[model samples]
Target: MLDLNYILSSDYYKKELERIDRDNSVEQGLYFIIQSLLRSTIEEKYWVTDISTRSKKHIGFSKSVPDLTILEDGKTLFNPIAVAEIKYFPWSKKEYLTNNERQVKSYLKQVDKVIYTNGIEWIFLYGKGGSLERKESICLGNDRNTPESYYECINKKKLLSQIHWKNESDFKVSWDDLICKLGAFLK
Candidate 1:
């Protein structure tokens, strides 16, 4: 389990999101946030990352680089297991879903399993053709559990028609039993 309040309340953790990004990308902020969280919580899996495999495709050849990869424990298994794709906070749900589906489909060619996330929305993908789909959806900011982060993104239509906006925070995550969830996932 992780200390959500302790970790999230820190200036260091908060600073990661405050930094400026190249080309004004919203996704850049989350790269830092996810990196910070992984560093603080799951160092064993992600820290000292296997940089050699960061963007390198599998043996045969592939065109995409997964946002993150958890190598298959070759000691126990002969092939790699999980690869992940990430989205940004500013993107609409539709954008994240469609883009991640495409990304996971591409990654599936090289690995057996794929994970999709937006730092908060974690969806596990598996199976083939007809069976290819999302499963094990984990929302770090669950609607009832963590409403502060259950945002639907900004409504551009309403912004033009009326000056109204939803009051939601960006990329905020808390322990909220995620320690148990992550423990199950990591295993």
Candidate 2:
């Protein structure tokens, strides 16, 4: 299982959150955070990278630059395993979620799997036979309006303790489950 306390409380994580709070390179900060998480958990054969430049050719995704892309064997865009769309804190706001979900669903046209997250809530979706299905929705914690609130949440261990599966109201989610699910998805 991944070490939630260490990962969440690390100096790097704290710095990234601070950068985000300052609104300095928000996308890059989010990318770094998510990249570290993916790199730490994913298999060796999988490469977690950012392909957010319009100049780069993502084949099927011409107009949109996916926040993060997973390539099998570090081969390139030709062998994409998954794509992640990241947002900032309070990304669960209805308007943001709705628009982001629509974008994620569009990615399903070419990629088999897509993840939409706000550094807290992870929505996993998979493409079927010309259709998209929401595989899971995992919430690491309840919404924190500000970055300081995040510090409080982690300090109090509320982030880990408040875990729950979005779809299954009664089901409690654990760090192991989060790591397992995300690792399995990437693999």
Candidate 3:
């Protein structure tokens, strides 16, 4: 289980997320949060050796850059097993989700799995039939207006899973559940 008390109470976490909420670097800020969670060593099966935030290139013809990538064995330079992208969609969420999927597919063909999130929703994608398919999706927030971080969202309502396609559906996520979802993503 993850130590939610430490993360949610930290002033630094709130300040950093607020900064991300105001800027275009949503992916970087999300990466910072995830990296911090992994550094907490909450999981015994997997340990995040490296996580690149839009700096590492996906091994493909286009050499596209994903928003976030987690490397299991940090020995190789580009050994990325899982990739994630944090998108901010304040308008036309469906359109943004479609576009983000395209962005993930363009670069992350060889990666094992991918996570696409907007801090409020998390979409897990898997490559299938030469395309990226939505494996699962969950909404961890009810308020769509100001969902810039997990702290803001979870404090508001009940935490549920798999509320992505349902409109007006409110779901929440615990820190341990979030870590399990992202930690086992590579496998």
Candidate 4:
């Protein structure tokens, strides 16, 4: 399980969010938080990285580049444990969901676990569940606001609050539970 307090209390987590707030294009800040979560939950060595830069062969299908690739300790490129697609909150709601969903479905064709997220909201996807499958395992922010409105309301406090928020669905998974699910995906 991930240590939420350890991540939330870290100066790095706080500072990175501030930096992300200033420059939406700098995705590396997310890596720090994700690495912290992985470090706490999994025992084996793993890498949270952008494999697009690795080599021509590693670039995803149709020249698409996923935002992050989680490689297990002994896993090869053919079998990454998980991959993610991230968008900045200010992007249009339709593009954020529609385009990203297309991209995530493409990813799911190869990788079993795919995480689609804006900085505030996370949606987990897995292939091969058929009609009964719930592509989104859990969401953290659980807000109904549109992407633009959500971005407009962002601040350090709001960001932290959203990160700590429970899932909106009947299941109501907490941050700790979400992290544990993520940990399971990586394992």
Candidate 1 per-residue C-alpha lDDT over 56-132 given as tens digits, one digit per residue, 9 for 90 to 100: 53432255666655543332212445555665544455566566565556667656566665654556676553246
RMSD of each: 8.8, 7.6, 8.3, 6.4
TM-score of 2: 0.69
TM-score-wise, the better of 3 and 4 is 4
Model 2 Cα lDDT, one tens digit per residue, 119-187: 666778888533676667776554444445545433442222222223333223444566678788965
Q: Which stretches of candidate 2 lie over 4 Å from their true place?
A: 1-19, 22-25, 56-58, 146-173
User: What would the per-residue lDDT of candidate 4 be over residues 124-160, giving only the tens digit for each residue?
Assistant: 7777421114566454443333334543645323333
- Pairs clashing in candidate 1? none
How many pairs collide in each candidate, listed in order? 0, 0, 2, 0
In candidate 3, stretches whose alpha carbon ends up further than 4 angstroms from where it belongs are: 1-27, 38-63, 89-91, 128-130, 146-176
User: What TM-score does candidate 4 reach?
Assistant: 0.63
* Span of ten consecutive residues with least summed lDDT in model 3: 162-171
Instruction: Report how far off residue 37 is in candidate 1 (Å).
Output: 3.0
The most accurate candidate by TM-score is 2
Regions of candidate 1 where Cα sits further than 4 Å from its true position: 1-25, 39-61, 72-79, 128-134, 140-174
> How accurate locally is residue 153 in candidate 3, as Cα lDDT from 0 to 100?
45
Give the lDDT of residue 167 in candidate 2. Answer: 37
Clashing pairs in 4: none
* lDDT, candidates in the order shown: 0.45, 0.63, 0.51, 0.56
TM-score of each: 0.53, 0.69, 0.59, 0.63
